[model samples]
Target: MTKLTGAEIASHNSKESCWVVVHGKCYDVTEFLPEHPGGQKIILKYAGKDATKEFEPIHPSDTLDKYLPAEKHLGPVDMGTVAAEDEGVADEAEVARLERVSRMPPLSQCYNLLDFEDIARQTMRKTAWAYYSSGADDEITMRENHAAFHRLWFRPRVLVDVERVALDTTMLGSRTSVPFYITATALGKLGHPEGEVVLTRAAAAEGVIQMIPTLASCSFDEIVDARRGDQVQWLQLYVNKDREVTRKIVAHAEARGCKALWITVDAPQLGRREKDMRSKYDEQAAQVQDSDDNVDRSQGAARAISSFIDPSLSWKDVPWFRSITRMPIVLKGVQCAEDALKAAEYGVDAILLSNHGGRQLDFAKPAIEVLSEVMAALRERSLDDKMEVYIDGGVRRGTDIIKALCLGARGVGIGRPFLYAMSTYGEDGVRRAIQLLKDELEMNMRLIGANTVADLNPSMLDLRSLGLHTSIPRDHLADQAYDRLVPPGLKAKL
Candidate 1:
């Protein structure tokens, strides 16, 4: 690879000819301008200079490899000859934050998932915290997602030989060390510099599956390539309005050896997340609307990028998705039994009973509450075994996993807690979180008198109060801990 002077690279900065340097390597992204997912304006901002800083945080290392042709790889640039931009003064607020964080307890002191959330809230940037922690409307469903798990009581079988419990399981036919996989969460860079790649590393090390989010800061190939050996990965697709774009994305994931395609069925339109919305609700958005570029990125992170998701996605499109890839198709946000039967009718492989972690519809039913109804509906239609079922939202403990499995869930997914862990302590935090769940599963399974996940049955759980909507006070101390960690403007309505 021939090294080019920085001056030579800078000469190609125009819409007609754009060359940007990332991590000391120059690439001619001239033809890729229109194809950029974030819109061409973002690339144009750093058109003539090193975009490493701007690109590194939001993009996976393999983004160029996945999107650019081999011919566009224009070798390296000479850093010695580069005219460095004026290093601007740091934000005073940021300095104060770093100083504050320096005085806090170390990551090792953080014991559980909720502890990680508290640490992440203190350490993360305000915008990031708002985005990760916010829920739709009054956040009733978010509270319910956690509370519903507590409603179900475990019926521990006595006098059963409970030695040697196995936490390992298969998700969508892929082997995982734990029954739970790291469910998809978007804009991971908002929490950590490495973004979703941090999750990829952690999942691989911990022997679990990682479902890569379509809106991830890291591109699909980057997450796939980050796998250690044959570690499994699943792709979570937020179908683009453009069918051609959807087709290409599906093909790419399948080609990259993704084990399954988990299409998000909710989010036809993004929910009004007050916390995220309020972050940019001030006069800045209006001021920026009149800028040279017509792009309005000020609507906070969620609204800014969610514009591309297809509102027309329907049951008809399921067949179209099936045609595009050989990977198993799973609907990610089925909230009712009727929809669960419809999913079986569509002949898809699975459905994750979820409400977008209560980030979507306010006061939506928790996945666990709907599980019994979905199972009964499937059984009536003789479709109970036709499609595998899973649940997510407020899964903090192995006991939560046990409850879902007892109710006929093939597996479970966990999202926000892992994000908080990643934000607080990076990969090590995630690794510890996974280990903690395994330890809990071992102990809980023994106490519940289940040696294997298969040993868990509906009879083993007392679900008489599961269907009730009444508030069940389980752990006020943990609730208060999370309450303190909530972002300032957003109040928990539970």
Candidate 2:
């Protein structure tokens, strides 16, 4: 039987509209109705219609012929003219999730996207929150992480009969819902009892790739299974002192269907987190043998470091990691263009720009600030064209995403915010948080008259008011980008 693609279903359900059916899934895109960064005319064409053809270029990873047929066969979307009460709707994706995740109240309530902090506070101890929430020597990077968005106030052009916006984009030759990577985090159980398992569920549902941490409580096989065989999972490796053990872990992740491997190079050693340092929290160090249900922090900070980390590491070990995996290799902590280019030289598949949530390095420029420089270099070698480039730091709004995208990131990732949401609500909370981010991204996209993330160019920005001087050169600007932007603690509210 012939079935309708998500776009066809959406078109059938709504009157006439514009929207992106990213990776064969549909989104409402109504709330982000007005703020498209692209001109209204282009967006309106997509209103109530599927923009799949528009998406193909950005998402080159999938073969169009196969996806086209599958999406159609998924089901028929009830075309227009049904009563309001009709069972009229369509379907979709995202994060890792254990089928074990609770769909009920305390669990369900935690699913809200807006309760970012509440969830973190709920699931984590005050000390854990301090450790997770606080950043660097003074948290400047933390503040800039969200504040960088203000530098680019979107310029929305009007009167073109706007209707829809497309959110699909390519990342390392793959399809994804948004141009945002589901950046990895430590100890999924810390956010919700479901831990990495629940995160995989969220990733499956949301259509974003999951970057599973090396320290995940659940085994790699467990995480892969929860993805339900419909996910693109990756590994986030922390090069440890034990090269053999580290290689083993990387090999395990690859063996378990992981498509990419992200080696975090920024912390040859962990950063000094004053917030965690000042807290009453003691670290668990490691799990009690044979017990799957409890964390023993009795050994305090000493053990926490032991269990949470593998200290002996350096860039020299990149070749060792390369020898073990056929999957894409990404470096997770490139703060500058130099590092990004270096990763390219080392034959990495991608480069993820981050400051480790200000967790590893203090006073570093927020990742967003240096995007222009990194992107310029990426573009220089055609590496940006072949390999993926990502940024993660102080990203809280769609506008921040736009700035980075304009500067040339294949995509961006959010760590603390989603982790905060997960801590509070579990899978549903993560869903909500991701949705909110998508909404914010769509809103800003519409406002600026831009359709794709790649359309976000510096020309759309008026950095002049933000104390930006064109003469200083992009390199210098990237270096000082965070200093000039307002912090999330200040006036800018996404």
Candidate 3:
């Protein structure tokens, strides 16, 4: 394989014949330009240049090999002869963010998960913060996810021995240290350079399960290999339009010892995350080509990478999934009782009641609310015992976990909080976050007169105001992170 000179590669640097260097290798991406999910404009900006810095965070290491044909994999580039990409004037926002990072409170000061989020909001890059914090449309559902937990007050029992409170629980036949698992979130490298592997190591240290996302910045094998002995992992999948691609992914996950297959069912199409879209637009504005490009610029990172998800996925595909692997199948993102019952009927091992962390379907009920309804409906049909039930969305504190378990949830999934921890302080931060939850869980259990997980039941919760959609007290930390929505044509001056 001959190494290509920088001058030779630079000559093919237009829409007609584009080439770019990534990780010291050159690739002819001219044919792939139009097919690029993030749009051709981003690719054109890095044409004939080292795109490694831009590419490493958002895409998996195997992206080019998996998506691009072998013919386009040009030989290595002699980087010594390559012209260095111009580093223009420093961004003022970035300067401020760096100062904030320097002034961030020590990890010991973060007593709770929200504290990590508060710190991350002030320290992360603008695009990264926007992508992680933004929710669909008005973000009413996002706020309501945490707020709904407040609606149900606790009913503590007295005159009961609470000397030993146990938080150990099992999900899908796996015993975990706690009843919560780190749920899947995409683009881990956007927050931390090490990506999902950081969560993997943290989960291992804390003795909890980690659900690896299909869109993880680190490759699947990288996360799996990072696991300690007997550390459990589950795969969260977004079904691809190509059946073969989906099959290959499922087969690979099972072969890599993933314990469960969580099929995301709610997101046929991603919701409009305005903050992310605006952030992306701002970054790309200076790079816009003079020509009328057909690429959609309004979609942020969410839509850009999600174009391969099969919108036609239906219940009929359940049997096909079962045929592919023996791993326990879990239907993630189930929002209603009807769907939960249907999932049980389809013979899935579990159903995770979720609304995509309120990133999909703006008005969708919180997973905790949906959990209550589903449990009732399932018990009515004598199907409550048919499958393990789990819920995710706005689970910030141990009290939230208690509420779900009382409502018949086998366990809960927490996504954003852990990501915030990892973003703010890496592996140590994540471990601290888990420890804090454990501390809270034990204290809450002892107060509620529960000695073990089985001791928890619906009797421990007062559901009188559970269904009311009333406003809760203002959350200063969340409000600070939130980007308030403005009415159309009423943009406020920044």
Best-fitting candidate, measured by lDDT?
A: 3
Residue by residue across 169-240, what tens digits does model 3's lDDT show?
Answer: 899999999999999999999999999999999999999999999999999999999999999999999999
TM-score of 1: 0.85
> Clashing pairs in model 3?
none
Over the stretch 1-494, how does candidate 1's per-residue lDDT look in tens digits?
66989889888888899999898888999998776645566677667688887676556677788679999998888977766766577588777667656655666666567777777777787778889999988999998899899899988998889878988877788878888999999889888988998999999999989999988988777678888999899999999888898899889888888999999999998887878777752223344333454555555557766878888888998998888888999999999988998899889999999999999999899999889899988888888878999999988888899999999999999999999999878899999888888888899999999989889999998989897886555797897677554322222223
- TM-score to true structure, per model: 0.85, 0.65, 0.93
RMSD of 1: 5.2
lDDT of 2 by residue, 1-494 (tens): 45335435345333244444444445444433342322233334455455544333212223233224443323333333211223234222111122112222353343223346643543355555765676656776677666565655555555533367889987776788888867877655544556677778887888888888765655566677788665787888877665677777777776777778888877765655667555523221122221222333332222243343555565777787788778888888889888878878887888888888777666677676677677777787787766677888777766777777877777888777777777756787777778877888887788777767666676776554342423323677667676653211211222
Per-residue lDDT, model 1, residue 80, is 78
Candidate 2: deviation at residue 11, Å? Answer: 70
Candidate 1, residue 189: the lDDT equals 88
| lDDT for each candidate structure | 0.84, 0.62, 0.90
Ranking by lDDT: 3, 1, 2
TM-score, cand. 3 vs. native = 0.93
RMSD of each predicted structure: 5.2, 20.3, 5.4
Candidate 1 vs candidate 3: the TM-score winner is: 3
